[model samples]
Target: MSDLSPTEVVEIEICRRPIFVVGSQRSGTTILASSLRHHGALWYSTEGYILNEIFGPERLDETYAVARLNLNRWLAREGVTREEFLERMGLGFNVLLSSRSGGKRWIEKTPENSLMIEVLGTMFPGACFIHILRDGRGAVNSMVNKRTAPGWVTDITWACRAWRRYVDAALEYAASHPDRCLTVRYEELVADPEEGFEAIYQFIGVPYDRAPMDFFRTHRTSSSFRRRIRSRSSHEALADLWDVWPLQFKRIFLEDAGVAMLRYGMVSEEEMQQMVEDARDPSDESPSWTEELEGYRSRRDLAAVVERGVPRDAVMLVVSKGDERLLELGDREAWHFPRDEDGGHPGYHPADSEEAIARLEWLRARGAEYLVFPEGSLWWLEHYTGFRDHLAARYPRVVDELDKCMIYGLQSVRQVPTA
Candidate 1:
């Protein structure tokens, strides 16, 4: 001890307060957490279910009397007072999270955490929460389509009720703890991601960084449902799903979720009543919604080919037809076909096969190592025979799944002289 210097002494500071992201399932929580993970000052771990098991009570009341009663019995057995038990538990939790935080603020995201905000607040007094609120129609639609396993709500009526319950509880907490909680709307976040994320950064006391705005390019979300819904625009997809609902299901949704929907500005009272009227005159003709959805799902199957065939860090030019979702599939660098001079979407296709071939060569010269054609863009091969032939003659085909996609390796191809 006499020989020890100040530099030799080790001091460990526990992180008692961490950021939490909470929401109803399929309400943009995953994407929000994924984006926040990119922040240099933050570390986001997978959902922490352990917190709920340990701290969350069966019934959450304003007084928390039931939780206190249960904890007090356990505290007595440990020979500690309530204050001492909480101090130790808080320290242990901080130690566990800090061990993996990489010396940055930690974030925990679990949809179920939306119900445990009050409990978590008591456990970590300084903890901040972000609640992502989605339109109940969109959230319930996704929930019904995905059909998550093991006790997840699958019925449309139950799904609507679940969404309303989560939203109502979170909003109630936010009303009392305005400084500690922030509520973000999913539609607004996607409409202007940069502005939305900037506000989030400010609220979390972190420096704003633009990297999070490009999360779609960097983070890969499990999006099979998203792929199926790609047959139409998001608005069209939601409208189609709503129109197909039976009269009873429509009434159930309106009864269970209509008020929360209005509170969140998702729909006006007039629109809600209009839905009720629309449900009465059910059309006899069925829409081809299922077939259209499956068609797009099959078209996106090419994403698997890209993930397996393309090398990591290689540059790929995908015939996406302006769909950025394809670019998020693999670990490779991808750009849209027919990109402009600045490497952005050109907003139009090539004028002819000659223009297409010219653009192909230009992109290749700029380090594009592969060209991929998913089924959705296979028409390009039929429409631009010259460009197709150019690729076939010069580049070796790496993947040739007939109904999925075709991949052409461009890195080592010898350019054939123009005829």
Candidate 2:
């Protein structure tokens, strides 16, 4: 991509003053974005294809790194520079929505945006961010029930982990950019739409009005979509986690979810303590052992928590050692690097040179188009650092890295000279 004149870039930037709405999947981001889109002063997109051009399929796992790669490609493809690309991508909705928004500020929301705050920040220096957070357990149940949870999302354990990631990112950015950011909780947002949206409006420096909230309530032409998203009493949702999620993930809910829960005030200390006590492994006599999982925790470690069957076991690939024990698969082949009896995991990643070659070979042989690496395996991606570079190098071939997982397209990747 060639650099553009500074004046041209600045002109494009001037045309773009956008707001981004982001949060975990099933966290009410869609409804909030939908409501905001109706504003006469704004236009928003539910699933803008331009984002796919910007960052493959919204690889939230390593958003910034991968987006940087795609941003350059997007710039070249659009015949724009970094600044021009930012302006074009950030405000492209104006053109998509055409005259509907009357050239007002555009809004875009994708669950992966939560993890891409820094990347978006770089794109639109002065843009506002509205982050919606849902209770970890509530989000887990809603996400799992969907079954079509994004590729970046794996299961209950990773669901909670992914939520914590987004909330933590929102909170961190809010701290640094207090004037530019707002955090809204899904439960509270639905409980009081007027109040929730008012806070959002004020945070965006727009006049507070109840009309947008009313529009959201009245614009439900599809009862099913509305019902799927409408706020409901979810106090019983916590109990559903126990029956739905595996044991290891329950421990993650007890151990790893605390920092964000406490920081965001999602759960009280007393309630969290009770949850921890209830989720304690019976074999471990030490009650406080969960804290030991703090620093060195890995996706593989959390995955090792399942000792019994979990619902929705017929997945593409089970990430843990207890697949045979916890998964009720009949004839489906589970992909892993062939484990040994001692319970050690396979030390293979598609990133490894030789491994990438062999992995692509095996996948092609099976006529597979896509391969899923559960979010659990890549939760703390830096723990396995070069992972993003590996996928980013594969570009459009890698496809998606959102919904808590990495999906590789075998045909596209196979064409990449075995990266």
Candidate 3:
């Protein structure tokens, strides 16, 4: 038995209104939401993927069904009845206050949640929405400047289209439900955090504390891509990373020229024409994980393991006791040494002068690509070369013959224990 202490786990919740934070990508959403996590009574995750699993890509027609499913799933997982789930969601205040400890609020933030605000409102009538908006020009500029998909790199035109679409959806949702929505522009947050947080504080009905705002300065990394990125200051700084033409185009066609911008009264008229021109030429490429290893083969192997009883792929070869447990776990074969009755070659002894050479030859003959002779075993085998160098010499042969095999290396600690 392990020596470490074991304790029972207790799950508790104290908040009722599930706070939903939504915003555009690279729009300071993570920093803002993660900062709010330090708030007492708040339990949240940055961009929970559960919504995508439940909702299936944010289409409007199926939104109601998806919301119901999400609610039901949450209820079942939390071991709460439907009535309790409904009450908790409606109160929006109970979950935070019900905790045994000081913590109280429960919230989740995801950029895609921006598209599902209406569905969310229907699901949790007591819910509050924090919509984080970045400057459209800066948003476009930021997308182009940072490590982005090939589509973003292909041209400023495509980037601008995406920006407008995201911002338009966000604004439309905000306008539709002004009472429930709280808009925090990224630029405002950076320039005057007190003002921005005051707006957030007022919307959520929580007293604003300046201390949590500093949490934004804490390092932020994109959970989706798993990359570290520097936080931007003002929206204008985002354009610093892009070329002049892209910045101009974002300012004109996408941010300044469009009716959406005019409605928001955000961008200037002078910027619109260049944005239109940029939109005329589109970049066709899109981002994908090209460097990731081909996963289909691994997936197929996993499926085989689950469905079939056969022992296949990366079996652990263990030295067995008389009980034969290892054989039960993995396919077994006799390992004869020194030319046994089966006419197999002799196993090399640790004491032999040419033991290392013999062991290598033995492995080659037995069709064993990798002979994992642990550290001390080599000294007995009369081997002098370092383990790494010895492996390097035979690596090519191993690849040619047994690349599919994985050999487990171990030190011979003790004789196999018999039960």
Candidate No. with top TM-score: 1
Candidate 2 lDDT over 1-419, as tens digits, reads 76766565333223255788877777777777788876667777565545535554344335434555674655345555555555445454444544445567777787777766765775677689998877877776566566554765655667777777877777778777888888887767766788888888878877766667987667632211224233435444444444446667667666656556655776666776666667778797664435443322333222332212222232233433333422222333445422323433455444444555454445446544334455454442454345445555653433334444454544454235644
lDDT by residue for model 3 over 14-74, one digit each (tens)?
Answer: 4445577887666777788888877664666546655545543434334333555674665
Query: How far does residue 48 in candidate 2 sit from its true spot (Å)?
Result: 2.3
- Candidates ranked, most accurate by lDDT first: 1, 2, 3
Q: Please give the CA lDDT of all the candidate structures.
A: 0.76, 0.58, 0.51
TM-scores, one per candidate:
0.57, 0.53, 0.47
The Cα RMSD in angstroms, rounded to one decimal, for candidate 1 relative to the true structure is: 20.7
- Over 4 Å off in model 3, which ranges? 1-14, 57-103, 148-158, 218-243, 246-257, 270-419
Candidate 2 vs. true structure, TM-score? 0.53
- Give residue 364's error in model 1 in angstroms: 85
- Tens-digit lDDT track of model 1 for 98-212: 8889888889888888877776676677788999998888888778767454445668778998898888788878988999899998767866788889889889899978777
Model 2 lDDT, residue 137, Cα: 75
Which regions of candidate 1 fall more than 4 Å away from where they truly are? 1-12, 58-88, 217-237, 281-419
Model 2 residue 130 CA deviation (Å) reads 0.4
